[model samples]
Target: MTVLKGARERWVRTGGTELCVAELGDPGRPVVVLVHGYPDSKEVWSEVAVRLADRFHVVLYDVRGHGRSSAPRPLRGGFTLEKLTDDFLAVVDAVSPDRPVHLVGHDWGSVQSWEFVTVERTKGRIASFTSMSGPSLDHFGHWINKRLTRPTPRRVGQLLGQGAKSWYVYLLHTPALPELAWRGPLGKRWPAILRRVEDVPGDGYPTSSLPSDAANGAWLYRDNVRTRLRRPRPDAHAHVPVQLITPLGDKFLSERLYDELEQWVPRLTRRTLSAKHWVPRTRPDRIASWITEFVTAVEVTGEPEPRATGRHAERFGGQLVLVTGAGSGIGRATAFAFAEAGARVIAVDRDPESAASTAGTARLIGAPEAWAETVDVSDEREMEKLAAKVHAEYGVLDVLVNNAGVGLSGSFFDTTSDDWRRVLDVNLWGVIHGCRLFGGRMAERGQGGHIVNTASAAAFQPSRVLPAYSTSKAAVLMLSACLRAELAGQGIGVTAICPGLVNTNITATATFVGVDAAEERRRQKRATRAYGLRNYPPEKVADAILRAVARNEAVVPVTPEARGAHALSRFAPRALRALARLQPPV
Candidate 1:
């Protein structure tokens, strides 16, 4: 009984063993063959395959000695890379005889598929390769050799880190002990272990054949790992376009393993995920989406997906990002920044037309997908509904920017309670709603994400004319700091971005408390003029926001004045307090 429902299952014979192959989608469409890793079977790709089935001829297969596939007699020499390659070719030939197939693999499957894509014999047969959580044994061998021979401090540290992560690989190579454990308590508890440690959903996966699969698949390491790592082939370069999806939180593999990989893969597109290993199960939607994007791009252009040219493109590419107040100024600039990095952008703002305009331009810049969502961040009900819709439609956000805010001006004595409420509602409470609603979803997803809250220089630099606005922003800054401390354990980073007097439309719309309508308009014009003289663009502040998220900075103060104020508030609070008494011209 296969775990994959509605899949057409067949058996392909190779090297005196039978392999279980399952496929879905139209045969005439481009073929996408998914290979499973060790200690598992074809069922591992069930989630990803179903998603890709609509767009491709999705294929999955159990490697020899796993699942329903018959184990080779004397498993010692049975599961060699050469044999696995043969099994892959047999499946490909059986399914898509004349046409080349897009190849995707995870873990051990990725390991074997590396052999498939690199070897000359199967060059023309493989159109493209997408790898996750696995490295080519050959490249890995060279990586180890390079570090061992040179031994720099950073290199040695990376070696040590990866050595610790590969403890299970060492254990797997041990004799009948691994087999005995897998056949007994370890097999029964494996599913629970995956759920607890990796946050893999407790769906009915791994199937009932886990014990036999684990026991038999032990030969994958026995036959290949030692020999390949010790005497790795130098010519094991990938002939096909490669898309490498590295799991940042993979316990068994270090991110540094793929350093300088460009030398081996000529056309490489790298992506990172803040997830534990077994991404196929945990991040199926993302995985499927990336694969579809890569395959479609390749099919249409007859080449790998063109790499995004933006800074941190590798970090944010294909990641889902939601930005509030994306209608204009800093919010719109931030949205464009993420879009330029190839992130999927959700341009959210209270202004429907402006949001839609931002979203449209975002797509043109570089975002793979962009959408407009109109919602007032201060309105809790509207925010709640927006969160629900975003999660349901767009999946969990990889980055959230609570950038929506309003400005207010007037002395504390003159500022009415209504003025304070208005400022707080749009600034502090808006950030609160965004974090509670969307940040909650990010945490619940269990995968790491980033939250950026738009604060202001007035948060740290006190001023007499902007009492209400300063209080709201000060609250936002404090809130961000507190949330950063709380969400740190969950791998979610919270940042407070304080921008000082950027040239934007906020000042024009800012309310002047305790002033007549004519006086308010005059003040707005004067303030706007003063800001225009400074002439700092919102794009610079937007760049700071992206950099802050990337570096996971605690509090980022944009512009020279903001940074100066931040420094003063930290080390010379008395001077800052003394300066707070001065009256502004505006």
Candidate 2:
């Protein structure tokens, strides 16, 4: 039988509003709220909710005036933020009863969720929030439009830039236009437009089921954007744990909108979907499994797992190990780990001071010689010069660790051309440059050396939110694999090291496309690092790298999570995808 709760939808009263909500799964379990987008209702999430019910108390809801809910007329003062937010609270209170709910929203639903989480009264009512195709309203503007691959079509985007490019909005504002449109050719156009904005075009949804409700639901546009906010509480907002998911081809909003959200919310996870705007239906299983994993990752309180202990026979007496982005995190740890093993280290970093610090530590650890150099990995000429110098001074490169990289936040379209180029250059091309310049010499000697190319969990798969970063890492992975196969006969070992959630400072080295020179400089000066929850120390990653070199492993995945990801890479692509989606993008 079709789950009764799946369509067991209704409206509930709380304070001055009555809002619609749909129930699914076990009400006794941890409550989760699923909110859909414009021209869609709670039913959009029905299939996803049914799949999630095994572990969660799922609540799928239509926003006011959508689905089977009451489409109340605008009050005398009209629709406002306070009113809409009030409606959100009413839905949660009714569905979740006394407890806080895990909230997930897509499109306009995400807009409402963002507002609700920012407000004092309802903020605490939420356990954690996941924003799909949305970010903080204040910061989204920059990340989306900066260096998008295709600039919005001038006619549509610019016309809409003035106010609205959507006829649905005209209907929503014209009182009866939407209802009439849904009954006519306009309704046929709705799904097409939504598909363009969402990513999955005519993927798998029944748009004909409720034409009238679909059209009338478009009224939310007029309701939220037209009317002024009823109340403002400047101090009411606080950063709650937030996860943002953006699709790469989402025509409506670019991923760049989320770049600064990490700054606003201290605890934030960001992800990208290689999808269209209609995310829930397009990648339902992946999205649902990710929700289950994220909601359940509670912190363990007792003793931490003991660190691994081992012995290696490899000698690092004078092998020069060049590490990049070495100021902090795994890169630093990797550099220090090599030094401790008796390698003559060349600690290279974008920051001279950071390089100096690593050199100082290496010296303290009894390294015969620890050289610090400041060079931008993205600069080809600089990298070339550095490699030549290393060959002249050290004579042999036992290991060349390409560990420099930058982080990009928000959607794929959020990045500018410059942003894309810079990330790709550093994360992908840096390794290429390092290997080409250094590997050739090692091969020429016939003695052989090892190359560890640092990639991320994101490397095996692409992320919706990080277009540039993911693209770069993916290229790096393929390149390393190609190199490994081709160079096997030469006795030179090539290893791709995919690390999961190691703490590092990557955001600081990133630059925005088209930013003013002064502004870019200012950004660089005050760059802050983005972090992950399950942070692994840098030394751990360094140890993994060294071990991989010794074992002649093709791919040295650092964490158990990375190992799991590698396993899933072939045996279970779908389940692996779901597991991969558990972590945020940026």
Candidate 1, residues 1-586, lDDT tens digits: the string is 4569999989988989988888899999999999988788889898899999999999998888888899999898999999888888899999999989999999999999999999999978999999999999999999999999999999999999999989998999888999999999999999999888877777898899999999998899989999999999999888999999998778999989899889999989898876779998887878898899999998999797676688979779998999999999999999999999999999999999999999999999999899999998889999999998999998999899999999888888998878777889889899999999989988887667999999999999998888888999999999999999999866789999999989999999998878899999999999899999999999999999988887789999999999999999999999999999997775
lDDT of 2 by residue, 1-586 (tens): 2323435666786444456666766778888888777767676786678878888888876565666566556533333456667777777767776887788888777877787787777755887887887544434333333334346675335534423323434556776666677778866676775555443335345445357656655555665544322322334343456766665556666444555565566666545444556667665654775576556652122111121122331234335678877777777888778777666788888889989999899877756578898888888899889888888876567678888888765455657777777788888888888889888887775444778888887776545555677678878888899999988755567888898766655545555433566875555444443334455676788888878876678877777777777778868888856654554522
Error (Å) of candidate 1 at residue 321 is 2.2
lDDT of 1 at 123: 75
Error of 1 at 564 (Å): 5.3
What C-alpha lDDT does candidate 2 achieve relative to the native structure?
0.67
Highest TM-score, which number?
Answer: 1
The top-ranked prediction according to lDDT is 1
Backbone clash tally for model 1?
0
Q: Which TM-score value belongs to model 1?
A: 0.90
